[model samples]
Target: MVDQDIFDRLLQFRPSGAPVLSVYVGVDGGPSALRTKLESLVGEVLEQAEAEPSQALRRSLLSDVARVLDLAARGGPPEGSTVGIFACHRAGLYEEVVVPRRARDRAVVDATPYLRPLLAFLDESRRYCLVVLDRMQACLYELFMGELEGATIVVTPGKPGRPVGRDPSPAHRLFRETADVADEFIHATRAELLLVGGPEETVAAFLPFVPHHLRGRVAGTFAFDPRTMGPEQARCCAEAVVDRYERAEEASLVAEILDRVTTGGLGAAGIPWCLAAVNEEAVQFLLIDEEARASGSACDACGWLGLVGATCQRCGGPLRVTQDVIEEMGAAVIGASGRVEHVQAPTPLSQHSVAAFLRFDVPHSAAQVVG
Candidate 1:
């Protein structure tokens, strides 16, 4: 599912100039639900456009709304009893339209315009990952893993009929191929996570083949209705999975490093931290959660600091509490050349802590540490 906070933000968004139209198709009996869906859809579309009215997005939203309404009028609902809500720039333009034979087809046709804008945004955003899974039977399963503004890695399970099966005995063969493909992709892109989304069964069947080393980076599987899966859905699924994976990895790494530091075991820590302590050099990496980083709290204000101190023991300054102490400490370990890697925290962490990635010099003894 899309992040609820992000979804909520999309829902309340209002656009200036021409009004955007929103459509909702639900099986529920209440008209209120319909109204809510429509309103929310409109808000989301506008918000996705960053509250800016792009002519291309406006036209696409209008077209998608029309097509969805047409589908609703003709067939009532699709196989899943799916509730589709659409919003556009105008209700009249999309109202009373003719439904297409295939809802998925119509969706793709109308979604092209919207996908363009989304693609542009993805290409520009510095903090995001795009995962693309093409499940079309005739085509090979293609997985593209890449950061929004960084490197990208593409993996394919080879042509579909290559003796791969879901059977248990074939698990070894499947794992070998998958690992080979993943290794190649990882080596080429240097990405931290791999996101795979498609039919639930397909994703599940293929999961075991992913190498053990990459398991932590596999993230999670996402369900996509084949008939309704389009470029937009693919993009959304990729973003959701990548965002979650990156966040989880960063959090895990940061937490591990912090545990060592708080215990005076920095010597045993990973990359940036260990190198910093040994050389007494400025840490070269800093990772901070966007939300936590926004608070502008002093380093001594971190919640973990209480475990270490009540005030700025080093500077005798007041401390403000925050959930990002591990990140801050990691940052301090990796001084000058350090670079911050921001990631969205997983739902669990979002409730209890913040996460980030810090990079610094490699320690001379780095080979001894496992991270």
Candidate 2:
């Protein structure tokens, strides 16, 4: 898991005179295979850097890359599909991060670090917490992007006998105790969504005891016998709940955007309109279909993005054609500190593939309907 504080610290690092080496290498499969592959990759990166203009800077950069190699050789890769290494001797910045998602091998030497991929992956993975509880035993599971971190049994004391009017029942008191334990774990994990599963009656009893804030964030409940359930079964149930919740949220966002487009309010649909909104820094939230693609052009000089053009209309500069303009638009939105949502398949945004809620309205004329 990438530590939020550490990530923020890395982002705060200032650029120095020398170039920073940002390397991301895949480390999936066997550890031995990864180790062998990583050595060759590191050698290739260093060999290329040696031919750079600045001899003195290249030597210093090589030393830093050597340090990264040493660290990897000693510790091997952390438990993840990919690892990110950022090193700069001049800036005195050196860090390695294990990312859950897969990343292609990339080596870049730039004044500032290349962090777009990591940031995008983090944005895509919203953390969730799963609590499986029954009468005798309870467990809490922390999930990141549908992958289970670990699970542990929760311990709580049994409640006293039931009371009459205005007094809590024994079952209520017991559930409240379980909720307290679960609450502490949830806070520590910083889970965005909470899902509860167990025998039906226990889940019913526990739901009312959950704190109001957490209760609001509950995705949904499912049925699972904690005593009989294994890790795989628990993971499947939690993932299903999250999938359903995310799908519903996506549907709601698409519906809201459609309504806003019709009313000429805070939303815009289609690639051109969303691109315009992104350029204007007007997007509050960007909605894009998961498998949607829009091949378009962007101006390097003026940073103008459009669906079509041989040359930039705003600037006379030449245009650079891209495979997917939506990706560029997403990067722009993230650069402006706006949120992004990649809606799953079978969404209402299927036709347009791109949509956004703006910080302020752009007139309907700005949007162009594209096939």
TM-score winner among the candidates? 2
Against the unseen true structure, what C-alpha lDDT does each candidate score? 0.41, 0.75
| Worst-scoring 10-residue span by lDDT in model 1 | 111-120
Candidate 2 has a TM-score of 0.68
Candidate RMSDs in order: 16.0, 5.8
Question: How far is 319's C-alpha from truth in model 2 (Å)?
Answer: 3.2
Give the candidate number with the greatest lDDT.
2
TM-score per prediction, in order, is 0.37, 0.68
Q: What does candidate 1 score on TM? A: 0.37
